[model samples]
Structure formats: structure tokens, C-alpha cells
Target: ATATATFTPTATATATATAMATATATPTPTISPTTLTVAPASGTYGGTVNLSATLTSSGSPVSG
Candidate 1:
């Protein structure tokens, strides 16, 4: 008498994943109680005087 045999094959699978990110912006604070100065504190009649001002915001200089 005689006998027979058979064979089989198999397969595998793979997968991958990714992550995302986000960003946000911050705001600046405002300045208060500004100051001004003059070259001559007081002037006589028909006299010329010079004046100027100092501006600041949150302790930082502001763009013109």
C-alpha cells in the first residue's frame, strides 16, 4: 500500500501611526501715565523753549 501528504503557506501584515501639533500667540500689555520734559522749565515773555516726550509700553520701546 502507498500514502500522500500536502503543504500550505501563510502571510503577515504591518501598520504605522503619526501625531500632530498646534501653536498659539501671546499679547502685549499697554503703558500708562506717560511723561514729558522741557529744556526750560519756565520762559519769559517772547522767549523760545524746547519740549519732548518719552513713550513706553510694558517697559519696552514702541515702534514709530
Candidate 2:
């Protein structure tokens, strides 16, 4: 009498996964207050007067 044996093979499995990423945002710049000055403290409507205003942004003057 003759006997036969069966052989079996095993397989290996691999998987890849990815996740979403986020970025940090930058802070906003701050604005400085405006300064206004007038010459001759008081003036009449008929009289001429001079008015001046200083505008600054981030501690620097803004260009037109």
C-alpha cells in the first residue's frame, strides 16, 4: 500500500495608512492710533486755519 501527503503554503499581507495634517496660522498685525493737531488752537470761520494729521501703521508712516 502507498500513502500521499499534501503540503500547504502561507501568505503574508501588508497594509499602508496615511493621516491628514494641519498647519498653524500666523497672527494678525496691529494698527496704531491716529494723531491730529491743529494750529492756532481756535480760529474763526472767516479766518484761515491749518490742520495736520499724523497717520501711522505698525509704528511706521504709511505711504500713499
Candidate 3:
């Protein structure tokens, strides 16, 4: 008479995962300053009288 049997084994566990990244914001562009003025505020001429000046940007009036 001979009979003996015993066995026990159980162990398994694993978990790991993560991610984070964020960045978005860009806006910066401004330029203003362009003028040209000329009138008959003070002038003294004889024989020829013809003067004119006009140049603007934010007002519309500029052509290359």
C-alpha cells in the first residue's frame, strides 16, 4: 500500500501604461506706422503751383 500526490502553484500579474503631452498657442504679428502730409499751409510761388502728397496704410492708399 503506497499512494501520495500533492502540487500547488499560481502567481501571475503585470500592468503599466501612461502617456501625456499637450502644447498649442501661437499668435503675434502687428505693424503700423506710415504717413505723408503736404498742403498749402504755407507756400509762396509764382509761375508754377502744383503740389500733392498722400500715403497711408491703415487708411488704405499704398501701391508698389
Candidate 4:
């Protein structure tokens, strides 16, 4: 039946896509390419400078 045939291909494509995505996702997480930011790029050397740094990957904070 045409209905059954259409359903079969759609199911196949979905399964294939899901399988490929799962296979790629679990083994390899793309968390590289990070950004590092430090507050107050310049400060007086002798004075007390409260410096802090934040590291992020893909706009998400990287856990310390």
C-alpha cells in the first residue's frame, strides 16, 4: 500500500538519523574551542587588584 510504503521510508530515515546522531554524540563531545576572560585587563602593580577569570566553551561556563 502507498501509505505503508511512505511510512516505511520515513521510519527508516528517522531511525538512521537517530542512530547516526547517537553514535556521534556519546563518543565525541565538542567542548573544545574555549574562551578565557579576565577582569580589569590592566591594573596598578603595587595596589591590590582583585583579578578574576572565567572560562567558557560555546558560551557555556566550564566547570572548575
For residues 1-64, write the lDDT of model 2, one tens digit per residue.
8999999999999999999999999999885775443344567989987676656655666666
Q: Where in model 3 is the C-alpha error above 4 Å? A: 1-15, 37-51, 56-61
lDDT of each: 0.62, 0.71, 0.77, 0.72
The RMSD of every model to the true structure, in order and in angstroms, is: 4.8, 4.8, 7.3, 18.1
**Model 2 pairs in collision:** none
| TM-score between candidate 2 and the true structure | 0.37
List the candidate 1 regions with Cα displacement exceeding 4 Å.
12-40, 61-64
- Residues forming the 10-long window of minimal summed lDDT in candidate 4: 11-20
In candidate 1, which residue pairs clash?
none
The candidate that wins on lDDT is 3
Q: Residue by residue across 1-64, what tens digits does model 3's lDDT show?
A: 8999888888898988898999998988888778876666445665556787788878877776
Q: Rank the candidates by TM-score, best first.
A: 4, 1, 2, 3
TM-score between candidate 1 and the true structure: 0.38
- Tell me the deviation in Å of residue 40 in model 3: 6.6
Q: What TM-score fits each model?
A: 0.38, 0.37, 0.31, 0.43
lDDT of 4 at 21: 38
Residue pair clashes in candidate 3: none
Candidate 2, superposed: residue stretches over 4 Å from native: 1-13, 24-27, 41-64
lDDT of 4 by residue, 1-64 (tens): 3554334444333333333333444576565799999876566888766768999988989997
Candidate 2: deviation at residue 30, Å? 0.7
